[model samples]
Every structure is written in structure tokens, then in C-alpha cells.
Target: MLVLEGVSRRFGAKSAVEGVELSIERGSFIGVIGRSGAGKSTLLRMINRLIDPTSGRIALDDVDVSALRGKELREWRARCAMIFQQFNLVGRLDVLTNVLMGRLNKVPTHRSLMRLWSDEDIAIALTALEQFDMGSFAAQRADQLSGGQQQRVAIARALVQEPEIILADEPIASLDPRNTKLVMDSLSRINRDYGITVFCNLHSLDLARAYCGRLIGMSQGRVVFDGGPFDLTEDVARQLYGLEAGDVIDMPEEMPAAVVAAQAATPPVLAAH
Candidate 1:
């Protein structure tokens, strides 16, 4: 489990995150939705100790995280995968090698600098690419692929890390509809197949409603909403994001057949634990 206790991150004169307190259960898929500059990114960064909190604490499985540094911190970071809005793959590197970079934590820095990737690591990365339907592009340079395919390579890279927690910051912000669906589907698959705890910061409500079990809304560096999708009403969204909630969700084509089928078979809302 992940726990945040009165976590506050101050950046110079501003509080990027103010007194954040929440608990994330194992295997839960969560989405953080907010307007730009709402501090969603800062909050997620603190969870992985990417940035230090000016006050309060973060714990994973009851162990304080901010207290760790150096090797210990590196190890923790390896266990928590972070993906950015920009697919951060090496443009010059092929997709396979890009994904293999995820294994850097287990390899010597010298080997990495030398570009010495083992056959097994290469094979694992290829498998991850296959999982995301980007296997055919594995031999292509990351820059050679389209934005959607590049994002898949990024996902493959994260998979190579074998992380238990995946944190994504506006992963689909740069994609078109088809690409967004592709990326979101990959994220959904990992969350379901591996039971990895997926935490994402997104602006789209439709994607969150479709993929996440829990939604967290932040505004002015504070968490104002935490609940199931149904609880994220229009008023709540406007209060948190300052935009009409309906305006935040894009309707793609007709409603997806799979979503329609699921809605027919599944309850409209899953009860909160």
C-alpha cells in the first residue's frame, strides 16, 4: 500500500502540493484529473521521491520513503516506473534498445554507456513491444516511428523495468484519438494482467471513467475530490478544474463497443472500499 501523510511540497514561495493525505491500495488503478498547473505533476513526483516534500511524509508498505537516498532511493525509483507526456525514448536508439534502457538499474553504468545490451534483455524488451503491438517496430529507430508507436515503445520500456507501480503524467496529452486509445489500452492491459498499481495524471474524463477505478481531483495544490467516477460530478470537476466537466471528456466516434458491452454487463458504479 502507498500512504501520504500531510504531504506538502513547497517550491520557493509557492506550495506545489499542500497537505496531501491519501492512501492507495495495492492493485488499484487511479487517475488524477485536474487543469494544468493544478499540481498534479508535483503530487505524483513526490510519491516517487523524484522531488522532496517540504513537509510531511510518504510511505510505501509502511516504510518512510523520503528518508531514503543514494542506492536505496535508486532501487525504489526502479520499482516505480515514471512515464512523461513526451515519450522520452532515445531518438537515435531502436525501439528494442530504448526499452532495454529500463534495465539500466540492474546493469553497470559503464555497460550502458558502452551500449552493451545482453541478448536476454533485448529479448525481454522485444516481448514487451509485442505485448503493445509494436514488435514490428522494434528494429526501427524511436524517431522513425509515429507518436503513437513511440509511446508504445515508452510503455515497453516501463514494462522492462518490471515495476509494481506505474506513474504516468499526461501520457496521452500529445496523441490523437486513435493513439490515445492505443496507449490507454496498453495501460489498461498492464493494470489488469499484471495487477500493477497504475497511477496516471490525465485531463480527459472519459479515459479516466473508462480505465480507472478511482479518481482524484486536485486544485490550487490541494486534493478536493477522491472517489469513484460517479462521484466526480460536473460541479465537482468545475470546482477542481475550473472547466465544465463535460467539456473535459472527448467523445470519440460512437461509444466504444467494448465499453457499451461492459456497461451492459457491469454495474454503473463500483462501490467504494
Candidate 2:
């Protein structure tokens, strides 16, 4: 389980995150949805210890992850893998090589620079590819695949680590409708098949409603709503987005204009968990 005990972050007089306290179960697929600058990304960063909380603690299975430093922190970070909105793959490297990169912590830095990986690493990378149904693209360079395929490769890279938790920061924000479903489906599969707890920050309400078991809404660094998707309502959405909710949703132009514009606007509505 992951625990956020009164986590807060402040930069001078501006507070990015407030006293946000939440607990996530071991296998829960949680979605964090809210407006931009609401501290959704900040909260996700704190889970992996990429960003430190100013006044509280984050724990992974009873371990104080936020307090871990140096080598210990590195090892703890290895337990959770992060998936970015933009697929952060080595563009020039083959897909298999990119997935193999997940083993860098276990390999010496010298060997990593030389791209020397053990046979086990190759096997694990292959297994990851198979899991994502991208085995045929193993030899293709990362940049050669389409955006959806690239995101799948990134997911494969994360799975190769066998991490217990995954933190995805608006993972499908850049994808088209078809690609978005593909990426979200892949993540859901990972959560069920491997029992890896997924904590995602998203922008689409429909997508979140479709996939996540639990939903969390944030605004200005404070958690406004936290519960199951069944608990979500128009009233709750209004609370999350304020007066702009109706004006925004009532906009008309295309079939998916609401989501298309939302994705393009300042205060985004993300999908996850």
C-alpha cells in the first residue's frame, strides 16, 4: 500500500500542494483528475520520491520513502516505475534495447554505457514485449513505431522492472482517441495481470469513469473529491472545475469536441486509474 500523510509542498509563499492525506491500497487502480496547476503531478512525483514533500511523509508498504536518501532512495525508487505523458524512450535505440534499459540499476554503469546486458535481461525484455503484444517490434527503433506503439514500448520497459507500483502522469494526454484507448487498455491489463498498483493522473472524465476503480479530484493543491467512480456526479464535477464546467461541457462543434477542447485548454481533464 502507498500512504500520503499530510503531504505538502511549498515554494516560498506559494504552496503547490497542501496538507493532502490519502492512502492507496495494494492493487487499486486510482485516478487523479483535476484542473491544471492543481498539484496532480506534484502528488504523483512525491510517491516515487522524485519530489520531496515540505512537511509530511510518503510511505510504501510501511517504509518511509520520502525520508530515504542516497543508495536507499535509489533502490526504493526501483520498486516503482513512472510512465510519462510523452513516451520517454531512447529515440535512436531499438525497442528491445530500450526495454533492457530497465535493468540499469542491476548493471554496472560502465557496462550500461557499453550497452552490455545479461542474457536474463534480454529474456525479461522479451517477456515484457510479449505481454504488450509488441514482440514483433522488438528490433524496430523506438522512433520508428507510431505514438501508440511507442507508449506500449514504454509500458513494456516499466514492466520489465517488475515494479509493484506504477505512476503515470497524464500518459494518454498526447494520443488520439484510438491510441488513447490502446494505452489505457494496456495499463489496465498490466494492473490486473501483474497486480501492480496503478496511480495515474488523467484529463478525461469519460476515460476515468470507464477504467478507474477509485477517483480523486484535486484543485489548487487540495483534494476536493476522493471515492469510487460510482460516487462521481455532475455536482462533484462542478465542484472540481467550478463554473466553467457547464460552459465547457456545453461547447459544441464536433463529435468529441468537448474532450478535444478540454485536452487543448489550460485546465485539462485527464483520464487514469
Candidate 3:
């Protein structure tokens, strides 16, 4: 389990996150929802140790991850992988090489610097790409792919890391509706099949309701609601988004034909899972 106790972060006088307390179980899919500047990204970054907390503790399985430094910090980051709103891939590198970058923490510095990937590592990277239906594009440069394809490639890279936890900070924010569904489905599959815990930050209440087992609502850097999706009442949502009483949240029903075709083309390796 990952536990956060009184965790807080201050940027000078401004508090990005404040006194967050929660316990996340293994293999759970959680979505953090709020309006802009609600500190969802800051909270995820604190968990990954990309940003340190000004007070309180973060722990995974009884280990004090918040205090870890040097090699321990690097290892913790590898164990807890992060996916961003932007698909952070090297434009010049081939898809295969980009995925192979996940193994850097496990391999020797000299080997990684020289790009001396072993056959075993290559196999793992290939398997991940195949799962995401990107195996055919292994030789293609990352920038040449469409937004959806690039995001899938980024996911494959994360998969190769073999992480216990995936911190996705608005992963589908930039994609179209079709790609959004695909990305969410892929993350869901990973959580269900591989037992990897996923913590996703999202703006769309409907998407969060569809994909997450648990919903955590944040407002002004503090968690005001944490429960199952069904427990998120309209009143609470109003408070979370700072909306008026009668204002309705837009819930669009869309499943593009392209999404169906893409799913059909996804390899059986992932479909079975």
C-alpha cells in the first residue's frame, strides 16, 4: 500500500498541496478530479518524489519514500512510473529505442550510454510495443506518429519499466475523444492484468466515473471528497468544480468508429488481458 500522511507542499507563500491524507491499496485505479490549480498534479509529483513535500510523509509498503535520497530515490522513481499530459518521447529516436530507455535504471551506465541493449531487454521492449499495437512502428521516428499513436508509444515505454505504480497526470488531456478512450482502456487493462496501481489526474468527470474505482475530489489544494464513484454527489461535485447549484457538468456520449477499429486491431496479447 502507498500511504500519504499530512503531506503538504508550499511554493513560497502559496501552498500547492496541503495536508493530504490517504491510503491507496495495491492494484487499485484512482482518479483525482478538480478544476485547474486544484493541486492534482502537485500531489502526484510529490508521490513520485519529483517534488518534495514541505511537511509530512509518503511511504510505500512501510518504506519511507519521502526521505529516500541518492540511488534509493532513483530506484523509487523507477518503481513508481509517471505518464504526462504531453507524450514525452524523443522525436529523433525510433519507437523501439524510446521504449528501451525504460531499462536505463536496471542496466549499467556504460551499457546504456553505448546503447548496448541485450537480447532479453529487446524482447521485453518488443512485447510491450506489440501489446500497444505499435510493434510495426518500431523503426519509425516518434514524431512521425499521430497524437494517439505517440501516446500509445509512450504507454509502451512505461510498460517496459515494470512499475508497481503508474502516476498518470492528465494523460489523455491532449487527445481527441477516440484516443482518450483507447488510452483509458489501455491503462485499465494494465491495472487489471498486471496488478499495477494507477493514479490518474483528470478533468472530465465522466471519464473519471467510467474508469476509476475510486474518486478523490480536490478543491483549493485540499481533498474534500474521497469515496467510490457513486458516492460523489452533485452537491459535492459543485463544490469541487466551484459551480452553481443548477449548473450541469457536460457528459457527452461518444464512441467514434475509429475507436472501434483501433480496438479491433489491438493485438490479442492485450485483448485477452
Candidate with the greatest lDDT versus the true structure: 3
- Candidate 1 achieves a global lDDT of 0.83
For residues 2-108, write the lDDT of model 1, one tens digit per residue: 99999999889987888888888877788998888889999888888889999998899967888988998998888889988899989997888899999999788
The per-model lDDT (C-alpha) reads 0.83, 0.81, 0.84
Q: Per-prediction TM-score, please?
A: 0.90, 0.88, 0.90
lDDT of 3 at 219: 79
The lDDT of model 2 is: 0.81
Error of 2 at 119 (Å): 1.5
Show where candidate 2 strays beyond 4 Å.
Answer: 244-273
Choose 1 or 2, whichever is better by lDDT.
1
- Summarize candidate 2's per-residue lDDT along 206-267 as a digit string, tens digits: 67756777788998898878876545567777777777565423322332433232221112
Each candidate: how many clashes? Answer: 0, 9, 0
- Candidate 3 C-alpha lDDT tens digits along 1-273: 999999999999999898898888898888898888989999999999999999999999979999999999999999999998888999999999999998899799999999999999999999999998899999999999988888888888888899999999999988999999889989988988999999999988867767877778887888877876555556666777765323424533553343322222111110000
RMSD of 2: 6.7
TM-score of structure candidate 3: 0.90
Candidate 2 TM-score, true structure as reference: 0.88
TM-score-superior candidate, 2 or 3: 3
CA shift at 228, candidate 2, in angstroms? 0.4
Clashing pairs in 3: none
